[model samples]
Target: MFNRRNFCQASVLACGAFAVASSHLANAAAVMAKVGQPLTEVAHLDWLCNAVGLTSTGRLFVGLPRWPGFENTPSIAEVLPNGTLKPFPGGDWNEWEPGKPNAKALVKINTIHIFDDDTLWAIDQGEDAGPHGINPGQKILQFDTRNGKLLRSITLAPAVLPAGANLNDLRLDSGHAYLTDSGLGAIIVVNLATGVSVRRLADHPSTKMSPERRPIGEEGRPLQMPDGSDHQVHSDPIEISPDGKWLYYQPLSGPLWRVPTEALRDTQMSEKALGDTVEFVYDTGPLTGTAIDSAGNLYLAEYDRPRITVLSPDGSLRVVAEDPKLWNPDAMIISNTRELYIPVPQSARMAANRGPGGVDGLVRPFKIYKLQLPALYGNRETVPALVGKPLA
Candidate 1:
């Protein structure tokens, strides 16, 4: 014979108590969770590999930049199932040497990507010759991953790619390709069909490195160049949204910024107008690379720390994984199987980071790591299926 009001109050109180308990449990689980525990060493190589690319069909490729020290290594190779690397596309493609005919060979491959159509794309930054300037060798080459046959090559013209232009990263859509010129701080857009290229947002504030921001290395110190200047990289990491509507990018020292893809592709848009369209995304502190899931969540490689953080669509941020071995994780990739491939290039140990040493402090036998993402994060079904659809 309890009163109806009393019973309703009691039920509400019980529900509230249960909710509070559930929340406490969830928080405890998150605190005890070791997201980095699942991270495993997938491939180990003697040379420095900066970028990892996975094809839709599961073929894996790694880009080895012919940096100042490692000049003779293959610019591109396919990681075999046995964890060995085979020079990709065979023959003399990987046999590039100084003063040789490099027009047809791989010069300095800074980044590589494989589309769902089984096309392997590589960006030759032409820095192998010692970052003198952009040359005829600075080109984008596409190959059929299945057959290892060169399909098309598009060279960056001097008009668009000036001297000291370092083409860092690229993202492709059905109609155009977007690239970051880190050296000069600009975004380059290339028409996929016509091979026509245009430089946009040249030295814009968003693309330029923030003078107030400096990168901290795994050693817990500020990274400096040989001349004692702060290690500066402008417009380095680039990513296209899952819907292909927005292009997100930032410098090595960053607060992430983005702009509409429509503005970037608009040939008639004035620089002032285009620059106005850029929107501030988040204050991402020191990032190397980024990948976006189908749900528009961004997985960013935290450069200052050995960790990866995911930014949800709702603007909440959380650490997805952290490992002490992730030293200078460069360009990252998300495979079709929902695994995030991370290449620890140890760039922090490079010559630039070792002040006045002029000697590369890179630890040999660099390792590439892979982490199986939890189901709470996006799975294979949530991965952006940009394969058949036009990215735009």
Candidate 2:
């Protein structure tokens, strides 16, 4: 006796209930953890907070990407330990207008990296992909973290950023920066001194997302793109060995790979040669972010399994911690290798999970958690002397 309308309503309600049950299961798994403990929620936000950075002096910076359900607000802000948000550097940089030179301003901050030298580097993802005539909206900015003043800004060349380039996270080594382009499946390397950035390993199997792995979420549900396509999280997490000899990188769903930084720095290196140099590491199911300690240990976040894994220099892998609270763990940073900070955005509840006209599924108050560990070395301040190293 039920009509089509009633059937559809029932289906939606059933799916919602299923999602809730999955969340409960995840929480239950958290209780089974025997290694690292559940995340200590630092600050809560009503909006999507995808990126986080911590300064040695204890300043916390958060980036809010302009995604669906994002109330028109500043894209980047500094969160005091007391949990107050202040527009970073300046609010004007976040205010964008159609005809204005918005590229110079902080349009949309995809990631932020706080260095030991008190410099804050940010990747500003300009407009979404479209036939807008290739605007110079994509760039990188460095600021003096101590005073929240701008230091330098570099607008990337059009060739470096093709249509649909999501320049995700970055790692700094010596005087160079390496960035991952998730949207186009590529890597971008920038010279900190010369401000010249080059794109590398475009469409390489190592940089491309896995066709076999789908970022599953609540109730074993696969995350979906806005167009109802399966969400393919591409090359995102990146790290540099403490010695700065090798650059470790992988797609969100990984079979981790690395190549010598010596080869990576060579502007003349052919794409085929670079591909030939890539060494396959372990197969990590899916990891969104990674950081390396001074001893060359790599910490990777497996958001789907809701745990963090550590890969040693000798190729040994172990689970550092597992907890249900690690939902959609995105950007991660290690503070002096003593603490690992992870932000859980619960993206399975975001709009893209449900496609167009999708209702908001996530609860309010997003989370940032940290893990304490034995004192270790971090590479932010230890720029290895790889400037003139032999590539051979």
Best by TM-score: 1
lDDT scores in order: 0.75, 0.70
Q: List model 2 lDDT by residue over 1-392, tens digit each.
A: 10111111111011111211234235434443444544566788766787787766777888887766674657788897678888788766877654567755776678887766657788887766543344357778877766667877777767987766777878878788888888767888889888888898885888888777766665555678778777776788888877778887788767677877888889887888888888776666567777777788777776566667676665555565667677677777777546778887777778767655556778678888887743333443354333243111
TM-scores for all candidates: the values are 0.86, 0.84
Tell me the spans in candidate 2 whose CA falls farther than 4 Å from its real position: 1-35, 97-100, 131-136, 374-392
- Model 2 alpha-carbon miss at residue 118, Å: 1.4
Give the Cα error of residue 383 in candidate 2, in Å: 4.8
Residue-level error in angstroms, candidate 1, position 108: 0.9
TM-score of 1: 0.86
Clashing pairs in 1: none
Per-residue lDDT value at 300 in model 1: 84
Candidate 2 accuracy as TM-score: 0.84
Q: Which 10 successive residues of model 2 have the least lDDT summed?
A: 6-15
